[model samples]
Target: MKFMHISDLHLGKRVNEFSMLEDQKDILRKILKIADEEKPQALLIAGDVYDKSIPTVEAIQLFDDFLCELSKRKVQTFIISGNHDSAERMAFGGRLMKESGVYVAPVYAGKTQAVVLEDEWGSINIYLLPFVKPANVKRFFEDEQIENYTDAIRVAVEQMKLNTDERNVLVTHQFVTGAKRSESEDISVGGTDNVDASVFDEFDYVALGHIHGPQKIGRETVRYCGTPLKYSFSEIHHKKSVTIVEMKEKGNVEISTKELAPLRDWCEMKGTYMELTEKAYYENLDQDSYMHITLIDEEDIPEAVRKLQVIYPNLMKLDYDNQRTRGKAAFLEAAEVEEKTPFDIFEELYEKQNNQEMNEEQKKLIHDLVEKIWEGGH
Candidate 1:
């Protein structure tokens, strides 16, 4: 059986303070187009189908439409909730949706839930482990104390182990080992909400999520499918992709990845004003690509970005090296300089406002006035 694996669609997400509903719709449509061309038997969405716990009405409709499309094509879909998803909301009507070949696992009731799919070759037992904090799992267990990611994941994995299916696949969302995080990802309290890669021991293959970069954890059997687009400026260099796993039989599996082209690339460039002005410097740059330009000139650049945007119109930021231009001595000698205190600055401005300089007697009179005010005699 061949399965297309994707994650972190983050539908209803806003990018650059702009509504990303259209971008999301275009990407999902493209994904379904690819799936139709490839004709995969099953589709595995690891986690974080929506960008927020409370998704917008438009987001809900987008997902509902996508699920209906997959159902129409007789494609089996397995989805699990992530940190950003509301468990109860995702699981709503899940039982009814399962009849249409869609499996939504939002909460871990007592054990891990597996959607069994069979083809001409054999049967594949795919387990969905939704995102859960260690405290929540500990509360669920009520007896044993779960301290960290490893402990909580162990509970779910142990439940999955009960099923002795030959070909088993685990779909999960967590901060797994060897995966890189995007800036947009929510950090747990003190970064303590992470699971080690060792927690998934017995599964034949693991499709992971939460991290925005696709990577293998300790072994090739466990991998993150990553997000479909660059969610943050920190993820500017990310090349998003979806994984396709073809299971032959038992332990033998072939995993292939296909890149999902983003709407545009995010780039960060740094150079002196003179260099940036040269035609050859940015000749290869895509004019429509989003960019952050850092000007390393001796002074503030007034028209640097304005000029560059003539070449690269989609420039988002322009920073000048003004601090470095002042030199280290300026900062180091600050204490030694004749700097005015707040009161002194205020007095000087006041004198300027009155269009006259304050004599020693006048200064002394102002000081007396301030003292009288301090004494509540205003």
Candidate 2:
């Protein structure tokens, strides 16, 4: 059985105030083209279909179009909600949609539902386990001892009563241990939300989401197929792609990836102010690509961002890294401050603030105020 594993669509996302709608549409078209050629038996979307719990009308329409196209192609789909999704919203019309080969996992209610599919070899039990928390598990299985995320997932899987003899695939959205995170991902405060990879030993293939970097956790079978587009500057280095899995039989699987080409690539450019704005440098680059530029010129340039935007229309961020900006360490020099008296420090601050030395009259006034305060304290 061949299937495409993808996740974290974040359809309505905006990167640095630039709407990704057009880029998302272009990428989804590319995905559809791939689907047409591969003709996979099913497509697995692990989670995070939208950027927010309450997706915009355009986001809903875009997703609807994608699903409609997949249905038209007779391609079966399996999807689950992520932390950013509203379970009730995602689950709406799920039963009706399942009739058309699109299966959407409802809000996790302690028990996981498995959608069984068949090929020439045998039956493939596709389990839809949406994002879950310890509190959610504890609500359903109050008697069970579920202290953490790992325990919660373990209990949920156990409830599925999976059969090891048959080929089983689990679709989950979670923060699995050993998975790297990107800036766009909503990470837990600590390791409290992490689930051990070993907990999914029973499944033949585990399609994961929630982390934006495509990577395997413990084994090849357990994987996170990252976001198709770069959602943050931190993900500038990621070569976004969709994971394709081919399952021959139980314990026999092959995984491969196909690159996703976005309308405008996310990138970082660093150089002096003049070097960046020069026609020679700017002409060769994709001016429309989302960019984070670092100007290393010692002197601040007037309207630097505005000038850069004239050449690189999609400049998202502009920052300076010259000596002036980088001169100050985050911490103050304690010894230098310690050497000065309170009055001396105050006088230095007054000069810096006024951009001039205190006149004799102002100096006497400050001295009198300081003396009065000192006498009162003594």
lDDT of 2 by residue, 1-378 (tens): 999999999999877789998898888999999898888999999999998789999999999999999999999999999988887899999999988999999888877878988987799999999898899889999999999999999999999998889999999999998888877777565677999988899999999989998999888999999999998999988999989999997778999999998899977999998898888888898888999999888888899888889888899999988766665532246556668777787788676433369999988998999999999999
Compose the digit string of candidate 1's lDDT tens values, residues 3-93: 8999998899876555668778888888888788888999989888898888899999999999999998888999989887888898898
The 10 consecutive residues of candidate 1 with the worst lDDT sum are: 346-355
- Candidate 1 clashing pairs, residues 3+ apart or interchain: none
TM-scores for candidates 1 onward, in order: 0.79, 0.87
The lDDT per prediction is 0.80, 0.89
Clashes (candidate 1)? 0
Point to the candidate with the largest lDDT.
2
